[model samples]
Target chain A: MSTNTTTRRLTMAQAISEATAQEMARDPRVFVMGEDVGKYGGIFSATTGLLDQFGPERVMDTPISETGFMGAALGAAAEGLRPISELMFVDFFGVCFDQIYNHIAKNHYMSGGACRYPLVITTGIGGGYNDAAQHSQCLYSIFAHVPGLKVVVPSNAYDAKGLMTTAIRDDNPVVFLYHKGIMGLSWMSYFEGSTNEVPEEQYTIPFGQARVVREGSDVTIVTLSQMVQKSVLAADRLAAEGISAEVLDLRTLVPLDRAAVLKSVQRTGRLLVADEDYLSFGLSGEIAALVAENLDTLRLKAPVRRLAVPDVPIPFSRPLEQFAIPQVDNIVASVRGLMTFKLD
Target chain B: MEATAEQLRWMYEKMIEIRDYEETMSRVYLEAKLPPKIQKGLAFDIGAGPVPGEMHLAAGQEPVAVGVCAHLRRDDTVVGAHRPHHFAIAKDVDLNAMTAEMFGKATGLGRGKGGHMHLFDPAVKFSCSGIVGAGAPQACGAALAAKKLGTDAVAIAFFGEGAANQGAFHEALNLAALWRLPVVFVVEDNKYGISVEKSASTAIASNADRAVAYGMPGVLVERNDALAVFTAAGEAVARARRGDGPTLIEVKTDRYFGHFQGDPETYRPKGEAKELRQHDPIPALGAVLRARGLLDDAADAALRARVSGRVQAAYDFGRNSPYPEPQDALLHVFAE
Candidate 1:
């Protein structure tokens, strides 16, 4: 439950900042470091006032060296310190990759299992704004290659707080990627247990659990991060046609809650995976592979469908970008196509 | 000396052992007894840059590794650039395993995943990146770990003058200075990177001068002299141990052979290889010790003979050691 009034309207950035602030007060080691995390609060103002409250030592403004600072966080974590690093924009993770690929995720197993880098790196990924090729792209697949790294993507204010706390508490190094689109919104009174409610203390949500935002049986829709909202909108559109859909929000990708997915699939013989990132080699493909490998008693009425961004660089034009990314219309059409289409 | 003459004698043994090991290994490779490790699919990535070689040696620059490693513990990290045989030996890595690694057998350090140039054994503080200047910043991170964790550990980055010209080398130095990390940038200037002479790659007269730009103290040393290396390293190591931050050491020297095995001496000044061999660090140290009355001719001969025996023993072990199981190669590649 988040701290909000009955009629409070909060943006996604405000929700994330609230979650971070409450956690820092909960644990002394929860510090923030990024390009503009300090005096700038955050480029999106997600870390505003954290600097003045926590002081320079706790809230740091790191150099533009992503690899250096990212490695510093991993190194610090190996020695019994917890670091929460921020990449001003997710696209910049390219500048420093040895930190994640070689250092953070590999530290535990490479040290002959003597160490655990409990580090959480937060970033804003994907496109919507006019931030062009170099600045816009969801590069999650690159990280999923690492063995000991957890991937967390939050869709709503409640899930953001819950998933981020899970990442912080996780023993392995985790990457918490926040989508830029799920940001400014006034829908605070909708999500259950979030009556703009406030808890006086801190808490955490368990990792690898899928939250069912909407429950139905005609079809099962699996989505993550910002794509969850798009799928929900699509499901609402599908409801008018007398078709019910079950929407499962996979808050964490690494420790995927296969049980939730299997149950939804068993109830609804059809499945569609909608994701903001490209479809191939992405989380949806991995899940589909799992389903094919398992082949439980769940018989499908139609073949599974995957709706995602096409395998092209994010274009800058608003119309083209809109056509490029998978919106609710795409999800609705893809699910509808699977629900009644030929199985051949 | 309160440091114990026995410990000092052990130190002497380590340096002698490292020097003779390289000299004998060079001959072994030259004789082609050490089979080339490259298979059809796997190529030997010489260094971070594209320097090709079946085997490389620290050659005439033995004391730099011997002296710096003398002050380092087995748990500490020693990051070496391309061609890092000296650092591999000084930290007391098993010579047999290292030789087999050069042979690209299943018994290699990375189980054939890493060839001679990619040698790394974190258990004994030995690791090298094929990339030139890549290890410097990582070493700074490793040292920062030690400092933040409140440990006495330090990181040693062994690179060449060419690597000091790399942006990573500069960035690593600037960051290490800003953080006051416990690291030592040990630049082994063999006066050339592959074939491009230092005259062309770098403008700073010496590797140590680059340290001044990062707000750190830089020192130059006669790398061919082992005692000079030991005494100089003792000061830098002591300062690091005192939490006084990093030191940049530019060891001015030359190699006795070409950069790698099988190179025609087209790059070197005529007769320079033979002339430089006279300054081989082990013999140079022996001469200094003998002049100082610390060693006698008989002791020097015995030291050389003992080193030769050790080299023979390592060769025998490597020659007989079994290759890694065909599938065991995949064991450490991924974490369970």
Candidate 2:
């Protein structure tokens, strides 16, 4: 890795669109379809200028039909085409879950290997802008729970581009979920940390690889997507207090980086899982289980703590929404609590 | 072309088989689910049945399946809604394996991973979903596959009237019409989607009318007769096979049983199921065959006996089959 390589700062959405445009240009089989993806340039600007370059045949705009386009993508993939289908929002999976889970995620297995769905389903996730219950959700855990889907959630623009390129090239179905709060949209205030220096050249990031944003020895804050930024901010604040907190951003959930998680937690001896998803039966619980299962070799100074959304619909009010979703303050407080813990 | 005598007889026999199979399932699904074997204060337990989980039996809706499937080949794909047995049986899915699947046996389709509503028989190009209106887009996909592969195989999606209101139905229609994919959408208007009536859930009286909005020919089968469904489905299938485009056909059928077997159906009116039973398509088709001098009393009895024996043997196979190993549930989640 040469640090002197030419790189330009790009937003998460621009990075994703660049990756998609590069892949489409590289591979004749790669095409994109979704609502407002063609002329309007995607609701989150993930496919900004593809229509003009690739034409309607490649970067087509689909009707507002998640089930229709998602199933069509699966079908097209089954017929030797790589399709990138956007679902506007992850919360809309309810209306078309049958196509997502029963077909897209299960067809290859159910067909006993006769059918392989090489497709990418991209959707926006997380709730920081108070889009209410139906419009905002970080439901990547639900997709990760399913068997056939590879779940990729990138934290920054650089990883977003690389991971998206990998997702589009994967033979199996992949659900690439991006947090709207981290996309750097002009309308919504985003974490500037998510916008990073991305190379103009095409690149790919392997799944199941976790990136340690900051190396520390006291506590490990394991998170992904939007929470990674918050965790980083909390780590920065905790660093001033001499807590020496570490932040681990899990890039993919299905092919999870179990080794990195265990190695980091093994080093720190204190673990705090910060997630934007629901509090129970989700990524937090899954991470906790991983630690508990490896307790025979790993030692811990304090119990593992979790900071996530409480079990409730994301409220429209900013105060309620902020209180529900894990914020920098919550992560800082959780890490502080872990620091003060004693083995009574 | 009109229906030949042989095709009519085949439709009648298939209808009888579907009716007998569904009736058998309705009875078997109630076993170990009633009073005294359940927890206190509960009228019935859906989970306590021999065939556990919710069972949506297509008893009086045999015509829609037989009619549409009669025009389908083994290579043609058929996607059915939650109440899917009739379509599965009509598509010639293995009766014993399908029955065993509902029984959650290791010998069943999907190896008991998919219960009654989620049967996947790729050999016959047949699959179904437990979700309402979920099959339309998938059917389009299958049709798109056939088109891309340069084959004449058509795809059929069988959903309910209530599903027409779902966004999937509209989107699939527009997509199929836009692509000119060889697919046929059949709506079995059985009056109710779970407890809500068609009049309550759907805005229009007929789902066929909605197809025209998507620039496709819409045909409505007013009667729940097999011959009527056969004629409409034959035309739609022919149009699809010719690569003309997609067509939507709505069959005014009857749901003999509740949405699921354990449903109390307090939302339905008194004598509604009884009224639907009076117009049972199984016997109605039999009369049609008799009027054409194609079936005598002896022939009808022989057909019924043959169908009943097959249905009973399937139930026996299901009942005798062993349950899937508990650990086996973890398998088949992904392809190796």
The candidate that achieves the highest TM-score relative to the unseen native structure: 2
Q: Model 2: how far is A28 from its true place, Å?
A: 6.6
Every model's TM-score: 0.81, 0.83
Q: Native-contact recovery for every candidate?
A: 0.11, 0.37
| Per-residue lDDT of candidate 1, residues B187-247 (tens digit) | 9888888888989888867878777888889989955666667777778877787899989
Report every candidate's CA lDDT: 0.73, 0.89
Model 2, A1-344: lDDT tens digits are: 36767799999999999999999999987889888999999999999999999998788788777889887787667556788999999998987787888788986665435456788999999898989998888989999998899999999999999999999888889999999999999999999999999999898999999999999999999999989998899999999999999899999998999999999999989999999999899999999999999998789999999888888989999999889888899899989999897753
Docking class of 1: incorrect
What TM-score does each prediction get for chain A alone? 0.91, 0.98
DockQ of all predictions against the true structure, Cα-based: 0.21, 0.28
Candidate 1 lDDT over A1-344, as tens digits, reads: 43362424455566667778877887776678777999988776667778888887677787777766775675456445677889877888777776677656654543334345677888887787767776778777667757667888877766676567767777778888877766553422222222222233445778789999899988999988777877888888999988898899988887679988988888888889887777788877887876776566677888878887788888899899988888878888888888776553
Cα TM-score of candidate 1: 0.81
